[model samples]
Target: MLTINVAFLLAVIVLVRLRRRTEARSRSDERFTVVIVLALGVLIAPTPVGEGIFDLLGQLASGITGASR
Candidate 1:
């Protein structure tokens, strides 16, 4: 049996989209790419990696707020 990590697949898609030439993409293409990336994020958000990301973002946000005060 072969198992695949969906997050990894999504990351690949996101990277490919990012690497594409900006001028070649239309508005709808941009929107579709955003949707795909958002879907990837939702898929990732329930895993351990997602938890770490949330924690890191939280700390970063607090640090920014603390620095600005």
Candidate 2:
């Protein structure tokens, strides 16, 4: 049995979208890319990579907040 990792697929989609020329993408194309990137984030949020990202973001946020005080 082969399991398809959705996050992997989404990452590929993101990469492909990023490789395209920015000037060639229309508004709808930009919206679709946003949707795909959001979906990719959702798909990745349950895994170890997600945890690392969360941790990194937390640290960055804390640093920013701390610096402001």
How many residue-pair clashes does candidate 1 contain? 0
- Residue-level error in angstroms, candidate 2, position 46: 1.4
In angstroms, how far off is 12's CA in candidate 1? 0.4
TM-score of each: 0.91, 0.85
Model 2 lDDT, residue 9, Cα: 87
* Number of the predicted model whose TM-score against the real structure is largest: 1
lDDT of 1 by residue, 1-69 (tens): 999887798899899998999999999999999998999989989999999999999999999999999
Residue-level lDDT for 10 in candidate 1 = 84
Using lDDT, give the best candidate's number: 2
Which residue segments of model 1 deviate by more than 4 Å?
Answer: none
Give residue 23's error in model 1 in angstroms: 0.9
Candidate no. 2 TM-score: 0.85
| Candidate 2 Cα errors over 4 Å, as ranges | 1-3
lDDT of 2 at 5: 89
